[model samples]
Target: MAVFTVVNETDLAQWMRHYDLGEVVDFRGISSGIENSNYFLTTTRGAFVLTIFEKLTAEQLPFYLDLMRHLASHSVPVPDPVPRDDGALFGILHGKPATIVTKLDGKAELAPGPEHCGEVGQMLARLHLAGRDFKSHQPNLRSLAWWKETVPRIVPFVDGAQRELIVGELAHQEAFFESADYAALPGGPCHCDLFRDNVLFAPAAPGTNHQVRLGGFFDFYFAGCDKWLFDVAVTANDWCVDLATGRFDGARLTALLRAYQTVRPFTPEENRHWRDMLRAGAYRFWVSRLYDYYLPRAAAMLQPHDPTHFERILRERVMHADASPLCN
Candidate 1:
């Protein structure tokens, strides 16, 4: 529920007519994302997520919509865009690209234990496998070139020590990717951001036995072609924590990796580079935080998140040799 701008009922009504989703029974701003203004729309027909693209341009909408469709068609649990009566996937609302999605059941897991970690891991691996054949022309935002371009933008904002570390890490990441041996691993589309909040878990009935299930794959805005191993590393950072300082979780990492490997076993080379990939994931978020921290925030009407939180995580990752015990 990231409410950046107010949506008038008239504007919403017009948008709904475009999709013919019936009258909006009730609607309110949702605050679960950073890039868009989302609202849970309850209509006479049913419930849906209405997203107003805040940061994405019109040209980028097709990539996201197609990706969602691709995943949904492949049996990956994701919110598929509900097409309009005219078969259009997007409608202009408040002069922004707007679309409606089926509301998925479940809530974000606030405190994920080992079991939850294992479930998430298995689902992520399945998602990776499902996305293996997706054909998209979009550039990978986490690619080596993107990292190199982003480093200079974030360097000045980071502290001196963190800056040096990032510089060194950048070089290491470059070397890791440039090596001919590293070029032979599996590659495909990946969910670049799989933070805890992005995952959803269904409510369980009292005394009923049930396994944790995955829900909506929201925020596919950052998703694109990337290394499969990097996706695992991002999951480790979100699901793993240090119990001593509440930093990174080791047990959760083990469960997650175990479950992920059960679906798609990692190659020997992928296993060898797992630790480095985890380190790179930590630094990726670190740099993103630095960018947000230093850049002037848009004062329009969006929620501002603290970039220091990720910076703290980055510092904690720097202290460990692998950070993820599961890599072994």
Candidate 2:
């Protein structure tokens, strides 16, 4: 969501001509993520997010855009991609592939409790189910294959301990991927990057029974077809872990997993492979953060996440694999 390619108001106003979105009132660069150029765009018609693809090509975009449209249509709370006047989901802007999606209401619940995690769990389950019939077949770009390709690229930049941990973890993942248990796990289109910041929540209305409700999930750029357990692991690794220690918060973890289970029961294979899947989730982010920290792309507001954060997480998951139960 970094601003790699700056879009001025005049440029955006001119681009808005392609849509019936009325005149652009204002737009500003968003600086949280490291991948693409993102901005909050407002027009007379409504609020939207403008994203300029940095690495993803036009050929690879339909999978993501169409997936979002599919989930949105199925009543999932996700940002819906807006079409151009000519009916294309995306078109070139500033010589790069760009598109607009309706901005979700509310903000990220960074410091969440059990109730919040419960809502997230339920929504994520619904998201996975809603995406079942989506026909696109993009692989998770940052999965095992990517780790194999990327580990060597960042090896020279890491210390001996970091190098050893990554190499060993990668080898373990390779073997696990070859196992029948891994193969038997239920698979689907997954939000592979459903970190705490990717979700939004708002306080419940005055008469509501809950403290807050999930506004929506956003940032579908990292989504792909993968094991559903892997998605659950990725989400739990963030939403249910203590920031200081990288240890699972038992109450929150239980709430989240139970809520998700109510929607979609876990398969026996998923239960058997749960711990390793957690390690895999941690490893994925560690590799990516290391790469982004050591080899960064230039963006106007880019801030690479600290690689050590996930290093601590991976180490914790490796050391305390049995410390938390999978679900109720």
Candidate 3:
């Protein structure tokens, strides 16, 4: 979500008119994420987000747009894609596949407590259930296969310790993927990147129940057909860990599991391999961060995250093999 491609006001206003969204009052680049060019848009109609795809091709984007539409239609709090006069939810803008989605109200709860974790857990479960009947099929693009292909490309940049960890984890994941335990884990459309920034929270109204509420989950670009258990683990790894030490927050972890189970209970197989799944989640991000760190693209506002953050996370999970946030 950085400004890779600049949009002139004249071009933006012309684009807005096609959606019947009224005059663009103002717009500015959002300089946070690494992949796409995003902008905060203000119009007479309301606030929206403009995303120009940096990697996803036009042919590869409908799955995402349709998935968001499906989730939004199912009462899930997702950013609904606004359609154009041609009735296409996405159209080319500035020679890139672009979309305008209703901006969810609220800010990310970066330092969420148990209640917030619980809310996200519940919503994630609901999203998985809602996506069960979606007709489109797309594999998790950054799954094990990608890791296998990408690891060698980045290993030359790592130190001794980093190299050993990366190699060992890659080997371990390869072996694990061949196991029945991995195969039996439930599969579904998953928000593979559900970190804190991807979720939004609205504060309670003056007369309400007195806490911030989970407003929505956005950033569906990384979503794909994957193990639902992996999705849950990925989420837990991010939402229920202390960043400084990579330690699990037991209260938040427990709350998330408890809330998730209310909608979709974990299978016995999923429960049995929860710790391993945590390792998988950690490994995924660690590899990704390492790749971005060493082989970064040109985005105007880009600073790749520290790969060691998730490295510490993977190391912690490996040490605490006895952890059972939910024993099922």
Candidate 4:
């Protein structure tokens, strides 16, 4: 949610007329993410998030907006897309597609505990289940094919060891993708980017044992149809990892998977390929981070994440492959 396309208050106040929302009380640019221009907008009605598409085109946007609407309809705690006066989910802002969604209630729990992990796991399982019947289909844009195309471009920026590790892991993932087991994995619309920051947590009510509830999940821009196990892997790689050393936290890992399995039991195939999927998850982020750090686009508040964090994660996943398990 970087500030790529600047939106002035004068322009925003004029644009607010398209929606039923009242006068713009306040709005500020959000500068934490890499994709799209996001603003925290508040009007006479309520709070909402405004996003101006940077890379995603109008043709490629409906899948995300529709998916959010579908999940919200299914009782998933996701942001609901607000329709315009003409019943459109989005409108043109600064010559690019833009939309607003209801802002979730709580804040992101960056320092998550076992209970937090459990909540995330349950919510994610429910999200996957909720999206099963969604009609729109779009492949994960940054999955295997994109990796193959991206690695060659990034190879020029790394050392011999880093290049060799990336190339070898890519070959391994290629083989895994070609396997019959991969084909049988269940598929659906998934919140492919379920990092900790994308989730919000509301503090427990008075006298509730201090158990925070999962407020909602956001950032559906990277979402797409993919194996449900892959989604789980991507989430686990973030929520269950020790951030400093890139190792799995057994308690958090167990809590996450057990909660998830209680909702939707994993198939035998998913369990069997869990470790490989974890490796795939780590590899995906590592490649993307390298690309972003080396070849970046100019945008306000766009701080490219350190590429070494995912490199450490990929190395851990590759070296300690046997340590990762689907559940306790």
* TM-score of each model, paired residue for residue: 0.89, 0.92, 0.93, 0.93
Best by lDDT: 4
Tens-digit lDDT track of model 2 for 75-119:
998888899999999999888999999999899989999999999
Q: Where does model 3 exceed 4 Å of error? A: 23-26, 298-301
- Give residue 228's error in model 4 in angstroms: 1.0
lDDT of 4 at 129: 95
Per-candidate total of colliding backbone pairs: 11, 0, 0, 1
Quality of model 3 by C-alpha lDDT: 0.89
Instruction: Please give the range of 10 consecutive residues that has the lowest summed lDDT in model 4.
Output: 319-328
Clashes of 2: 0
Q: Candidate 1 vs candidate 4: which has greater lDDT?
A: 4
Tell me the TM-score of model 3.
Answer: 0.93
lDDT of 3 by residue, 1-328 (tens): 4688898888887788779898788799997777888999998899999999888899999999999999999999999999999899998888899999989988899898999989999999999999999999999988899999999999999889888988998888888889998888888899999999999999877887746687899999899999998899899999998989998888899889999999999988888888888888999999888888888866522777889999999999888877665731
TM-score of 1: 0.89
Model 3 residue 241 CA deviation in Å? 0.9
Candidate 2 regions exceeding 4 Å error are 1-4, 23-28, 298-301
lDDT of each: 0.77, 0.89, 0.89, 0.90
Give the candidates in order of TM-score, highest first: 4, 3, 2, 1
- Number of residue pairs clashing in candidate 3, backbone atoms closer than 3 angstroms, sequence gap of 3 or more or interchain: 0
How far does residue 198 in candidate 4 sit from its true spot (Å)?
Answer: 1.0
